[model samples]
Target: MKGFVKNYSGIIWLLTGIALGSIAGLIFGKKVEVLKPIGDIFLNLLFTAVIPLVFFAISSAIANIKPSDKLSRMMGFTAIVFLATVLISAILTIVAVKIFPIHEALGNAQLSEKIEDSPFAEQLTKLFTTTEFYELLSRKSMLAMIIFSIMIGFAALKAGKAADQFVGFLHSGNEVFKGVFILIMKAGPIGLGAYFAYQVGVFGPQLFGTYAKSLGLYYGFGAFYFVVMFSVYAFVAGGIKGIRRYWKNNLIPSATAVGTCSSIAVIPSNLDAAKKMGIPEYIANVTIPLGATLHKDGSSISSIVKMAVVFALFGKGFDTADAIVLALGMTVLVSVVEGGIPNGGYVGELLFISAYGLPIEALPPAMIIGTLVDPMATLLNATGDTVASMVVTRFTEGRQWIDKAI
Candidate 1:
């Protein structure tokens, strides 16, 4: 039994969960929904551990990066890659709209009462929102903590020897939490099975109509972006061989992202992949998590698509200027107060409405798009995070990271 579990633990446990949960959900539906707490327990555990896990991992990664010309280049290159992916996504969104256009304006959308849009300054400040240390620890503010962690990392680098003890403590904590995360993953089949079962049971039928068409575009764009963007980044970094090697290694994170539907959920998997690929811990630790927090290519694509759908439904005409605003809005909104859990910062969709001057009624349907696209968007986001890290590592170190395990 031990040998069999060891041989196929990750795949077997999780897959069994999915299959069983889905079957049960199909048969019993809302009745089996009672088990949602089983899945919630695992998810909540991960969510709680991730705050500190990401903080220390990112801080240590940055601090340990020796100051040099390459470090400067790495920062610059990372930004370029991050923005490039998003910009490319914006472009693809135009194509996706043309290919799979949302013809009907949001007809069924109801006005939302909870329309709390933040100031641009407030949104930007949220990234480094350390004024209230407790707020930074919150789930909605993970990206904010990431910014603070990077700052701490730079300080540790300057402290050099004096910061060793502090840095070592962070390093130790990183390892410990990773182990805890693995232990938690053992329960993933149980938890995720229940979650997936309930989800499919409830929402599964919606996939057949208008929802399916839009979702197809969302997921279709994700696949196109991964193949093209990751391939392009890999080719530039290494070559055809590098692209081949990269695709070979990224299957797990790709699946995990699609399965989990949360970029934050796949951090441990990305870190593990980076380790097996022989990526430097400093580069992997910083880029993987930071990318999870910030580089939201999939979300960007979803935002653009949602914007197009809303504009079409409203019978609004879009000039190149409106398209540009959408591009910039998505980039900025996702960069700061990204849409997801902890704080429910749907600022990106809010930006969509505000930037284009759409009526309040559009938000309900726009939000519906956001919900359906989460998993597909997350998969692309996770895959891009690792690929972007690889590109950064190559340019900084002057060689591609050949997947040693491959």
Candidate 2:
């Protein structure tokens, strides 16, 4: 039993969490509200490590660049690919919402207070600030910290031995936090199960049916998108055989993405899959690390779903040209800042309430859609990250290069 668990702890924990949460939710129904604390505790624990996690993760990735020239080229190509996917995903998401058409009526506003309005210029500036150095610990301003960390990483490249020592320390901390993250995940089944249970208890399985249509539409679109995009890219990079090989090797990473619902959490598994698929170390390393945060195609699609759902629930329409642009802009913004935010699930809520000027009542539904689509979103994002590396390797090196067994 010990050997079995030691070998399959991740798989075991994931299945257990799902089963427990589902059972609990069904047994207690709305009474599962009592389990809220258990879920919240898990969320809080994840939150506590996020600050250190972001700082070290980003900085370490940047600090490893041996030559600035290579860094620039890799970043330029990866960024172009990442941006293209995000832009296209956002456009498609809008189209999907239009095709499906959520017709739910608006409910009363949930919260009375509003975020103090800021000029659009100020909001853009807030995305990367020079001030509020201390607030990063509490995640009051993550965008600023991301900016700061990047600057630090670039500076470390030129600062010589002292900088190397500092970055080494940072990398060490990054590894420690990664280990901490995995440790926390050991409790995932308990935490997420309870969280899901609380959700089920409050809303009941019947309630999911109300959301299943709109959310289901998004998932269906995601499946179609994945099959088409990944199949094309995989075949382009490695041929028909390559396509089969990529999927065969990708099972572990895909499951991890769904189970953990975290891009960073699945990094190790993704890295292993990349090696199995025979992508070069240079391409895989840089792309996967940066892509995890910046390449959020899933979030882009989810943001569209979020805005579309929120607008419908708020009695607004995506009818006018202005409404369409607002949806596009909000989708892009939410997806971009998502990786930078702590407990980024609130990202949709923050943008809708503050930027789009939707009433607070839209928040609950936004939150609901976020929870429902997250696993799929993460799965798409993770898969995209791997495929990106494959494409990059094929471009930089050659074609039909990977093994099917992998």
Judged by lDDT, which candidate is best? Answer: 2
Model 1 lDDT per residue over 6-64, tens place: 53455566667777887887888678778877766756775676667667666776677
Colliding residue pairs in candidate 2: 17-189, 29-201, 30-201
Model 1, stretches more than 4 Å misplaced? 1-70, 104-210, 339-345, 399-406
Expressed as tens digits, the lDDT of each residue in 92-119 for candidate 2 is 7777777777544323321233334345
In order, what lDDT does every prediction score? 0.66, 0.69
Task: Identify the runs in model 2 with alpha carbons over 4 angstroms from their true place.
Answer: 1-32, 68-75, 101-122, 202-206, 227-406
The Cα error of candidate 1 at residue 30, in Å, is 27
